[model samples]
Target chain A: MSDSCCDGNARKAQAGDCCAPDGNVMLLSCSGGSNVGQLANQACVELTQEGFGKIFCLAGIGGKLSGFVRSAKDVPRMVVLDGCEVGCAKAIFKEAGTLLRGYVVLTDLGISKNKDFARKREDIDQVKAAAKQASQAQV
Target chain B: MQIKILGPGCPKCHKTEEVVREAVAEAGVQAEVTKVTNTMEIAAAGVFGTPAVIIDGDVKVVGKVPSKEQVKSWLGK
Candidate 1:
């Protein structure tokens, strides 16, 4: 039902076929329905522009398609960005059978989740900075 | 060039990566493909959905994994 051209084709690809990488951080972020979700989305854009990591999709893993999931699982590491404490992003990774090298929750950084909220740059920075530190620490 | 397979390792992530390589190979471009597999790292990269795509640090697709042709276009093929 989506407008994008690849919607149907993406679903058709197998789950286990991994697309080889030339050694860069291919990333997946959970744009949840919360403020942190929005923050995550924005941060991904910044990171992508900054050459920090490459963005990948998350729904495909949940869909259980063969190619995307398989290629993703074959990666050296997969990062999960969970907003608040729900761990929704992590849940997707778990279902895909991929080992997560790092995991982050916005609430852990003191960001309150509220229905009527406006995402702030500072809040996104806090998460982004924290995630960067965590990634460096993991390495 | 930087190759990105955006997803948190879902089926889409795997597909994205596969398509990325195919696109890169088909285009004959040398680039680095990164798998952002860390929750904290992913958050640092800034994503709210399970599957997303960023090319060379630029968020290209947010929610869904596009097809090989779409990916090719994202890669500027």
Candidate 2:
């Protein structure tokens, strides 16, 4: 049987080959120029550093770079984190015709969007928890 | 010209390959279409996304499948 055979890899159609090297979940953040946006960005970076996921460039994807777009489409798992309700990160993927396996919104977690709100550890922690929860959801 | 499509044999990748073929035929351009499905090669080619087009070893298009006109234009036809 082929390595991509459908034995135990049921999510293959939605995700890529289960045996592929894309085990690292791709994480994207809006990272807008705001307080909550900054928190989302920091949380994604921490998640990457912690080996929970790999922070990918939303710009590259938005720019419609073929490789980045293709990778996003075929990645085993992808998590999109947005600050506030703008959902820019999610919009980028949607515009690029990519599917996100996980999604998080900071504002929904009681974090208000403001230009002056400083990124505190507590808020960051909350964002991290939301992201983790998103990644664990059955897509 | 050597036209390479970087993808992982996904549906979109296959679609890109087909589009390239159609574009070449429509433009009547003398070009070779290559599909690079190996993840490592795609990454080495600086493609973090799929369904990208590389022309003469230089990345030209990425992410979404290109339109026929866009493909022809990239081929300089």
Q: Which candidate should be chosen as best, given DockQ against the real structure?
A: 2
Lowest lDDT 10-mer window, candidate 1 chain A?
A1-10
lDDT of each: 0.62, 0.74
Per-model fnat list: 0.01, 0.15
Query: Which digits, one per residue and each the tens of the lDDT, describe model 1 over residues A1-139?
Result: 1211122334433433322232335556788887788777777667667766656677766775544565465445445577778877788778877666667788888888876558897987887786676566545
For candidate 2, give the lDDT of residue A45.
92
Candidate 1 ranges beyond 4 A from true positions: A1-22, B1-77
